[model samples]
Target: MDALNSGKFAGFNLSLLKFAWLSQSFGGVLFGFAIPMFAAFVANSIGGKLAFPAGFIGGLMSTQPTQVLNFDPASLHWVTTAPVPSTFIGALIISIVAGYLVKWMNQKIQLPDFLLAFKTTFLLPILSAIFVMLAMYYVITPFGGWINGGIRTLLTAAGEKGALMYAMGITAATAIDLGGPINKAAGFVAYSFITDHVLPVTARSIAIVIPPIGLGLATLLDRRLTGKRLFNAQLYPQGKTAMFLAFMGISEGAIPFALESPITAIPSYMVGAIVGSTFAVWLGAVQWFPESAIWAWPLVSHLGVYIAGILLGAVITALMVIFLRHMMYRWGKLLIESL
Candidate 1:
């Protein structure tokens, strides 16, 4: 779909690919289970012959969305439509389960060396795909839907007057992951809240900028507080980048800091983001739009309060980072837990 949208596929025009079913996000679920499953299996394969091919085939057959041809009254044309389910989490679970199952099958069923090809290609794929389909139908769909419903319920409870708990939950989720899958999930949930008009984008908006600014400040201020920059020389440039990225509302700039010292930086990020987000919400900084760039601040209610919250949050994060870094009397030797 993305390729089609780019208008730059193969040498062939393929302009009609614009209407590809994969381009559509049905029920807020992106492309079906196959993509993620294929990816999962490829990663799990470890260059194995059986696991990778089985994963690809099983994933494709796992949760085939019901595509129906319906007449479009307005256009007076027949169109093919399918309800897409993300099945991302489901694919992950299935890959683990089916990967093991396939491995066991191969190990247990000894056949003539010449028949190995048949076992890997025909037998394993069919068996694994059957298991994948059954699991998706009977287990992942219903259970995942229930969990998704629970998350929606939480988002509802987090609505306008977006409660303090709501602010903390969103911000902590956003900052802790530093732009990983967990953060994206929370962002999507928060976006649904904004789209439904149940809550504004205040909490996540605040969170999106806090990590970069806070972690950046830690790098710059280390010289004054800790006698020298605690981060390596290479990170000074990245620190600057982090600060610059913050203005653009990019949280990934803080990823280096988090990666460098996850134990210290992640907690600092969560604490700062939660404080800033909750503070801004408490001060009545409501933002309906999801944009968190510096240009978007003008549209936010109580812009001054929001800015103040960010500053306070950033300072708190910087201080915590410095203090935590200070606590290590020795790097690898002193920390018992780390050792």
Candidate 2:
């Protein structure tokens, strides 16, 4: 905003882009390593004001526990052994709380000059770590389990019999968070079905490419349709990147678009992807090789229909996002004028 106000375009924040793409480009790197590390940095930066070593304790404490899933051979069932840690989320919340707490303590609490040395090294870090750890384990962790568990329950209930709804649910999950935990949950569910032969990859295949392609199309047509650019100069390149990634079957490329206008854009992606996936499944597009959409053209039966479904969804998303953005701009303008 400041850059735009200064009649300059913003730089493509490569750090933000890296954070968005890290999980997709390198498996398990986003939440597991990148997010936790960032969380630690966030905590440390805020808490360090009082010269307390919050980032160190925060980073170590924020380390996410690995999610371990196993199939019980004897029981013939999948067993998840990893306990869900709110480490990634907790660190964000706790960083603010812990940082301010230390800052407040440092400013308000007056200890003996001799004992003041103990305040930062011994007192603050230890105190903050304990508070953050306890809060993370008791409050954050349990809540996370409940939320993710609900997703599991929904996937479990939406069995193959409810084909349309099932497909909608799958694509909606992917659209909700781009490449975050919700998307991962849906991917895991779909992968299990694909492995067991309970479903074709058509649902997953169509869903994966829609957001990027749709968003790319939106950027291309925004000026022509709306007489204004939906994306600025920095985002223009990202649109190209998104379109390129669509063929490679990576949805993370559209993360910037979704994050930039989550309330409006996410729903657009969701509706579009669900429509596309449902259409593809209804059209009897059977896809076995779920790796790359363009390369797997040979693996997809009813190839023309499958591609058409993706295109239809992309068009819907492109139109919907532009309309929504224009409406939001008008609403904001009206509110300011009335004020």
Candidate 3:
């Protein structure tokens, strides 16, 4: 454990972290469950509005929306009605099975790059549709519904206050692990909140902003006090780009910087982000998921307060990075000399 803590096996650590993030982000119940729910919603909406019969709707349900709703409903008599409970169940089963199968297929099959692109675009969608149809009707809808319902209930309990708490926890966790799985999980949840319209986009936007500005400030300040930069010059570009993306609510932007220098980078960014995010929430910024900091900035009710939250977070994080870097460097120098 201590060896892992010291990053003695960096490659293994990174791989493990990446796998964890991928699972939490898209592989687990959250994403796996979500696909069917979304597909069902879309299917129902098309079915309901057009009043398609079950058999009729089932066929075209595979298709994305188009202007062809103009087609005679009577001609497509099979689709002009609501799907049966079986249809609903069918969708969920297909989604869950497809999700696991896709994961397995990727692991088992390592196609060439050219083939990979083609597979992603063509093969996967067709396969997923077939899988969803088979499993939902044959196997897993009820279980999926229960799971989805349970999660929604838990998130609802969090409400506004819960969201703030969740955001804060995520911010702190990011500092603790930087590029580790825990930090990424927190960010993933935060982003998920934004994407789902649970937390305001402003909240997500604010969440992302804190880490980079904090780390950047840390680097700059470290240079100021000790005349030595904490990060390599190459990292500066990555940091700036990351900061920009963070403002746009891309929390993963900070990953590269943390990868370069976790000690100074993680803590610096997280503190800044938490401070910023908390302030944004307090200021009553409006957000719906999938439209975070950048998108919400223009729409925030308290624009001035939102801006202030961002500025404050950035400043505080920068200062923190600088202080930690100086201390760590000086301590390292002393230890080396003593040895």
Candidate 4:
């Protein structure tokens, strides 16, 4: 644990963070924003309602739209349409890979100052982006599409299993690793549904807020229970920070508390997620966007219910954690007494 927290690890984390920021920035401008803008422009110039879907898919996949143009004789109009990119998932996969690859190359290869400057500024980014986009379009897109279809099917089936089951699945997935692959997989399915203009009746959005908010509230409950002002004061900052992060749709904010006492915190977070998500689903809450933050409440179909679900979940989680902690403390005291 000490080694993991050492300066060496800290430096590595910093480097990785820098790499992620640079990659995401570059990807956002080129694929996320610019390409979609261009696609929309082209779609509009061709005179049709094709721009919305085209731009949406193009932006998601970070590629130009593949357009089909037709002249309608009755209306004397030129119409264009772009099918959703089969390779949409490739955009995310390739960008992440490219980011790490660039980092590795920068460390391993030394170029002359002029060449390095040129490559870093122009050559590398252009070539990598082009290569990734092309590969995604031609090769990876088909396979990615098949996988996307499978995931979509699974999610759709899950929805049919009734709200309770669906919410349970989503909540568990969201809480299992706290922003790890399982969480991302569930999120991807939710986003895919949104992209197709479908309202996903899911508790995932609610689950995202539960962990952090619940953990934060648990601290307050603990303080109230023990009347330990100094200890509570020390925890207050972290609790407040977690709550703020939860409002922004970040679950990782609860991670420190879970790490401190996994037995109590993890189960509490998971249960909170389940309860919140179930309530939200039962209330017919629908999320149009995959990322659900408190600020996006207006976008939720049932705004009042959504807010209620979150508060209920957070309160339940806090109480659970407080109860469990109290029990554990009592058991420890009993053992000490016996000894």
Q: Which stretches of candidate 4 lie over 4 Å from their true place?
A: 1-88, 96-130, 157-159, 162-170, 173-189, 199-202, 220-233, 236-256, 289-293, 333-339
Count of clashes, each model: 0, 0, 29, 0
Best by lDDT: 1
Error of 3 at 267 (Å): 3.1
lDDT of 3 by residue, 1-339 (tens): 344466656677767866656754664445433323444444444433111122222222322111121345667643332222322333433433444555555466677887987766666555555655554433343444355445446757967777677557655765455445564445444544444454544554565567765665554565567776666666666667767776666666667767765766676777787888677776675555344556556657778887888788888877776677668767773121110
Q: Write the per-residue lDDT of candidate 2 for residues 206-315, one digit (tens) a residue.
A: 88899999988888898899777756566677988998998987889889887677877888988899998899878778886545578778878999889999999999
Pick by lDDT: 3 or 4, better one? 4
Q: State each model's CA lDDT, in order.
A: 0.71, 0.70, 0.55, 0.65
The digit string of per-residue lDDT tens for model 4 on 178-220 reads: 7887787666555545556543735888888888898898776
| Candidate 3, residue 115: lDDT | 99
Residue 236 displacement in candidate 2 (angstroms): 1.5
**Each candidate's TM vs. the true structure?**
0.60, 0.53, 0.53, 0.60
Between candidates 3 and 4, the one scoring higher on TM-score is 4
Q: Per-residue lDDT of 71-157 in model 1, one digit per residue for the tens?
A: 999999999875333234444556667678777877888889999889778987787677666766567655644564565577667
